[model samples]
Target: MSIEHLRARASICALTLISSLTLASGCSDDGGAEESESTDESGESESTDESESTDESESTDETESTDETDTTDGTEETDTGNLSCEPEGDVTISYSIEVGALDEPPSVDLDLACTLAEIDTDGVTQVLILDCPELENVAVIDIAVSPDMSLPLVGGEAISMRYILEGPWWFNTYLRLDVEGTGHLLTLIDGDSLLPPEEFEFTSPVELTAVYDLCEPVSDGCGQRERLALMTTIAGEEAQIFDANYAEVGGEEGTEIWVGAAGHLHEIECTDTPDEWFQVLIVGPGEG
Candidate 1:
């Protein structure tokens, strides 16, 4: 072969080698690009997952902190005690009356009134009123007696009496009796007296009860009606009258009594027959 022909063949071979090398370099670059893109995608997915995880953790922490703050704040959890029923301030007996027949047997009636210096939220009271009257010229008969000395009263041989208390709450009523006079008395009827002596905590009616002579009187029966007209203090503060009628009584036939937050007053009319007996009741409060 000629030298020029050999030179041309060598040139062609060189060109072919250069072309193959270039194609290989391009294929390698494409493979590297695909690998880089896959790595980028994986890194992005990992970043997104990490961000979501961090956000969830932060949210949980914030929720826990809020719960702690709420617990630390001052707030009542439960109620502790029961309500009380004792009187909050000073109390007074405002009025009283004596209930019963006059002739056959000297009957008795009692009425009482009270006042409060201040009202309380609970409205509970522990005060109890009692009746203890003096029998100066009083007489007792076995049967019911009328205002007139002539005939016995209507009911059977019973000394019927009743006591009532007026208040916003109707609590059970109770009575204590002390006889400075000359007789022993027994309670005839026993009502619901075993209740708290105080009024209800809310705005309600007060309780009241009247217990008649459960046992016989200390003395058999007196023949005269009790004449009680004296002054006594009640609840250690209020002033009260036993038998004497106040000016408000006026000239009424039956025993007219008025009781209010201020005090109690009695009214008795003078009868033509001096032999008639007068019945009166005095009420007060003490530790019981």
Candidate 2:
């Protein structure tokens, strides 16, 4: 009821109000702290998600590199070089021998082995290249004579043989035979001259036999020296005609020329050994 008492009561009321305001401010500060903590948690979650995304990208890059390596390995498994030729088949060669002229009866037929050797050459050694490896560069020609066959009045018999080289490539080429032990290249043809389609009407061997068989006056013109010269002449004309005879070069005027040609041809290895059997290999240009 006094003035001092009233002042003291008013001071107490002011102190209470100040305390209430301080408590309210403290609560507001606590709420702001909780909000800030929640925001920090959210930031951490986003950082973790970004790290997982980076890991996935690195794994994809490694997988792509592995695929590239597999592709490179596939390309290395295919590469080879040159190829060679091999033998495959064979062919037949037929030979017919007769003791008389065309359309003769009692003829003998012979067959020989021939190979279908396919090869490539520059046209020069086509025959040698096409022949079988066992008989390469060597020609083997044989004749079969039977007891039933008869020798006509004429000296030599008629003989023929056919050997077809397989394939279209051999049609345009030629067949050449190199005489064994003789430096002679003989081409077979069917004419009285050295040309295509090989054939022969008379051979040197037959003529040599005829020189002895058909000689009536063996003591005079058909002596051994004269017969040797005649044989040389026949052999020389197998490739070409020289028109060689005793009548053409018998006297002293032509004796030198005939003797010279005979000497040159006699040097051939074929003339060294004279026999009744004709040469099957040397298919010379004949007097058909």
Candidate 3:
């Protein structure tokens, strides 16, 4: 071939080589840019996932701590017993007595006083106080029939007495009337004198006044029995005789009977049924 033709061919070959190199370089740069973008996207996703996981863990810990605090606070709230009923100040009691079936007005004097002795809450009854003996069982019979005639020993003479206690902080009041000495004769009467001996027998109904700290003594053989009989009334009975322990010997409801202490008839009452009488014993404070 000619020399000019050979030179032109060489030039065309050089230009084609340059063009191919430029295209290969451009394709490599595009691939690198795409890979870098993919790497950045993956790194951002990992960082977001880690942040969410940390927040969840912290939130769970906070919730657990709050729960523990609430439980601890609830355990410190219930400890005081029934001692909340104690009177904040001193209490006083005033009572009057009426002597029934006396020919003339009886001059009866009662110097009653109560002092706080102790606090007892264990047993069938709660809140029991020790009562002073001087203020507990004392029978005062101040009756004057006629200076002219000595009190007669007849069958139809009735003596009735009523007592009352007034106070702002009084809780529960109970009365106990004890009669001693048998030289003069005085017949006992029931709550209401309308019923006959067989119906509402003669049982004296005295108003019970609340005495502060008056707890029944456990040693007094018939004290509990006597208190129960006095609190309960029966119809058509003379006296209520119980054992020294006042545990109830047995009788029908509303029946009048006497409970004796050793040989002393210290309690008298008429009950509708024997069960009622026994119930009082069951609910009374422990004999301390």
Instruction: TM-score each candidate.
Output: 0.14, 0.16, 0.15
Candidate 1, residue 17: the lDDT equals 7
Rank list by TM-score: 2, 3, 1
Question: What is the Å distance of residue 75 in model 3 from its true position?
Answer: 60
True-vs-predicted CA distance for residue 235, candidate 2, Å: 13
lDDT of 1 by residue, 208-280 (tens): 2211222121210111222222222222332222222321121222222211111011121111111111122
* lDDT per residue (tens digit) for residues 1-288 in model 3: 332343233233121100000000011111111110001001000101001000000010111111111112101122222222221111111111211122211111222332323222222112212122333222222211111112222222222222211111100111232222221122111111111123212222311111111222232221121122222222322332222122222234222222111111122121110101110111111111
- The lDDT of model 3 is 0.17
Model 1's TM-score against the true structure: 0.14
| CA lDDT of each prediction against the hidden true structure | 0.17, 0.17, 0.17
* Backbone clash tally (model 3): 39
In candidate 3, stretches whose alpha carbon ends up further than 4 angstroms from where it belongs are 1-110, 113-120, 124-233, 237-242, 245-260, 264-288
Q: All predictions: root-mean-square deviation over Cα?
A: 49.2, 54.0, 47.7
Clash count in backbone of candidate 1: 56
